[model samples]
Target: MTGNHNAAPTTQNSAADIEMEPFTPHRHEQCRRFQIVSASGLSYEIFVSIPRQAPPPEGFPVLYLLDANADFALADQVLERLSRRPEATGVAPAILVGIGYPETEGYNQPRRHFDLTAGPTRDPFYAKTALTFGGQSAFIAFLQDRLKPLIRSRFPADSRRETILGHSLGGYFVATLATAKPDLFSGYIAISPSIWWDRDGLLASLAVPSPSRPQTIRLYLAAGSQEGETATGEQNAGTQTSAHDALRQRRRMIGNVRDLAERCKAVCRDAVDLRLDIIADEDHSSIFVACLPKALRFTLPFSSAD
Candidate 1:
């Protein structure tokens, strides 16, 4: 896709991601700015975009946390397009608080183990890499305790009008967060979670119950159908970079999502709204883009809560 050079440029405001750019066209006017202040002293950066016309509504629904700073623009684009569609989610114009990373190089491969993973083992995938691992627990604390309150102070966000969306390891983070503190956010959209993490420790944790809530929260889980199978018949880490391996990962991840969805149905059947979508022929990288509108529509409906 051609870069929208004419669109409003993203300021290099925070020390989080070395540089941040608007991944989507910014036609709207009510754009707002944000800064990062993590208690862990871990430097991070984030931004928020809103409708061009109206002041944000009180108790407005907002997408809270986003992983992979580089991917924020794509999400913003998706939201910008979908929010205009009356038939789609019917969701009103709202703010998108995109939490970005603090890295400048190799942005696609996130130090997600640090930002998303729960435990302390150095997985070979990210061991001794320039990017660090294992900050997710703190990250969540940052969101729940600090960043969120800061956003609420400025915008009209409902106490329960938040949705956390993540991809890959980020997906793993959302699932872990949902089960660990279900009340913290109102909805969850996990795309192709890394179910392989810690031998599915996060997935297993979801089996346990959280304190019951007065109302049910919604969850939308989607995976690409191409995750597990490749043009070749086998699975190997060496092939991860291959287009084929990418396809396989989606399949494998989707299977894991299905299992989790089933588990959600079994455990919080009546208390939660769980929907699993398997997109045909899409791979991991494309799944989030392909699934975003539907995911957002399903999780955060435009209709009034009344």
Candidate 2:
């Protein structure tokens, strides 16, 4: 969801009229970094921060994903903190696989536009940008076909204990994958997904029927107070704009997430656990940091014996 080298913001820089506010420090946790490479012929990096002083056992729970950029470090730290609690010992050792941008010029925007979208459109947001915006299908192929294999080769991980995390645009891809390929993961953490993407076309994609009986999937969705900086952020049918635009956008987005979650549940309620967290006093950027601990607790909870 985060772009690099101060690349152009995803939308027009009209007045910061719709710009959301910053995050409170109380919501953040410390994090660290471990590196890995992507299969896209790019020497990318992954950040894997484990719980402090946690012993390596038979196997620790794992989360593997893209968009490690910066927020992922905090996510690693948050997971580390959560894993140390008495209720979370088994879960804290969770190994995070953060896929970083390949260190190359113009690498940030291309990956952002490509890995986050499904396909092309003539909309203003993407019409003038590079043509690499909708390579999510290929990106998913890379994760399922290459990155997961590489991680399994390196770690003693149980495929059933895997979780995937992504924010904003990355969250969009995560949602797309959950609906399109539900069996690839056991849980999903999507922080403030870009529900406004492609004119909200992603929701329609979710309505597609499944070939096999849908399996129960663990899913969490969250958004921040300042998430609404554009049409994508919040909507007000009454007031044009007000002090509540950001909050409203976050609410609307969360509502959409809940609605989508319910729709999926209708198909396979026995197999799906969908949760929504619309955190207070956070915006787009700080949301991942705030929700990290909760995400870890919910996705990788420990069992009594193990």
Candidate 3:
């Protein structure tokens, strides 16, 4: 049939043109979400990732990750990829639990500042800023009394294989927990820990005796080679010369971490297995991602025959 070339084209109600449901982000296949209230009455969002394989005879190992709002995705992905081929990687499959705040901000900065720091800042510079501190004790109580029990009830967790991973302020929290309650976790991975916090008081306090425990403790401490450097002198000069001050601070951080590791080894004696690393060509901002793979290998090592 002949038709006019200028005639209006017919429209069809094809599947693509039909109305469809709104798009929602696809959830991770093995991850689940839940909420729990802390001892201080703060509600926290917890993300749990379980392995696809069946649990071993003892149970699945568990890793408690801090700063979950920002780090959970990376932790989950790394665990999944490495554990996929345990024979090649020597990393076993395990459960990963990320503890994060429910606030709209990816992180609750004020709460973290209060929870992570062991005590008030003695440095005049930080003191002038009026930041809050000294909530580590309460947070640890919450973890021990409230969170850990809940996790145990919900999952087949191997208490002996439990590990904790933290970076920056979270790393500081890890250190505080390791010293204050050494029996809590079997392994601790503190990447670029803020040993320089509170005028190095935390590092200084490491000289005190850690609680004696029968279980072997594995600790992995790492920092970026470029951390705390003033290579470009880009900051503005103030009461203190920014570049010089920054360089000094960086040197202090490196030194303090090394000293803390050594002191921990001494006090822990044969009970603790400590390993410290300086990641090449990395800095404070980039260290976490760069060091996480090695940190995971160290903290979660497994044999090929397993």
> What are the models' TM-scores?
0.79, 0.72, 0.82
- Model 1 lowest lDDT segment of ten: 1-10
Off by over 4 Å in 3: 1-27, 199-214, 231-251, 304-306
Top-scoring candidate (TM-score): 3
Ranking, lDDT, top scorer first: 3, 1, 2
Each model's lDDT comes to 0.66, 0.62, 0.72
TM-score of 1: 0.79
Model 2 ranges off by over 4 Å? 1-43, 50-58, 86-91, 104-107, 121-123, 199-201, 207-215, 225-252
Candidate 3 residue 162 C-alpha distance from true site, Å = 1.0
Candidate 1 per-residue lDDT over residues 153-259, each given as its tens digit: 76667666788898887787788877667777878888888766653576567643355666778788888876755522233434435754554553367677888
Residue 151's C-alpha lDDT in candidate 1?
72
| Candidate 3 accuracy as lDDT | 0.72
**Better lDDT candidate (1, 2):** 1
Over the full model, what C-alpha lDDT does candidate 2 score relative to the true structure?
0.62
